[model samples]
Target: METKLKVGDKVTCDKFASLTHNFVGSIEKIYENSAVVEILEHHKDDTVVVSDFHNRAVVALNHMKKISA
Candidate 1:
């Protein structure tokens, strides 16, 4: 389902790795079919090592769920 997301709204996003299945962050910006999620917290997934990767990522809107109103 298409969950309406807004900037600064807390949300959890689905990732490729099971361990990182739900990463928490806030919406930074919205695009056509996706939004930019600023990674704030997540499970320590060894398989998907993202130690050096940027915190911000563009994820599909369908892959995200609002955690806060």
Candidate 2:
């Protein structure tokens, strides 16, 4: 099933790649299978990767869950 996510929506992304923990952010842009998330909250251990990506991450739609409120 496809998740109805949109820009400006708050979301959390499951860990992937070198990321050691999940993270929270807002949707900045959307793609066919992923969205660009602007990092708002994240694990301290992921600081390096989060910063490296300029506080943004391209997270797959399936890996993201929208925050209700």
Candidate 3:
């Protein structure tokens, strides 16, 4: 299902590698099925791997969810 996401919304999404469990960021831009999330925090684990994604990434709307305060 597609979610209606707006800019500046805090969300949690996954990354390709880097042993991180989840990536926290605010929506920077929105597309048809994806949005650009400006990563603010990256929670990493013990395993390490080089990832292509940096400060921001185009994440699918379904893959992202609202962050509960």
Candidate 4:
């Protein structure tokens, strides 16, 4: 079993951008290509994360790519 999560895998989600793009909530549901991520907090710009592209909408799997520090 891998430490990271895969598609269709039930797990909790936490965003490091909780302070900025906090609109994303817990793991509500999973879709075919997109995960139905709920909105727990408030977010003005979801695209705050450069890795998330220019849209702060969907949290794609590739978005989980670790940013080199």
* Candidate number of the best lDDT: 2
Model 2, TM vs. native: 0.90
Residue-pair clash count for candidate 2: 0
Error of 4 at 8 (Å): 12
Which lDDT tens digits does candidate 4 get at residues 29-48?
44555554444444456434
Off by over 4 Å in 4: 1-22, 44-58, 64-69
The TM-score of candidate 3 is: 0.71
Model 1, range 1-69, lDDT digits (tens) per residue?
A: 656678899998887543455688889998988988888887776224445446777888888889995
Q: List the lowest-lDDT window of 10 residues for candidate 1.
A: 45-54
* Candidate 1 residue pairs in backbone clash: none
How does each model score on lDDT? Answer: 0.76, 0.90, 0.73, 0.41
Clash count (model 3, backbone only): 0
TM-score winner between candidates 2 and 3: 2
Off by over 4 Å in 3: 1-3, 17-19, 44-54
Off by over 4 Å in 2: none
Question: Order of all candidates by TM-score, from best down to worst?
Answer: 2, 1, 3, 4
Give TM-scores for every candidate, taking all chains together and pairing residue i with residue i. Answer: 0.76, 0.90, 0.71, 0.33
Error of 2 at 52 (Å): 0.8
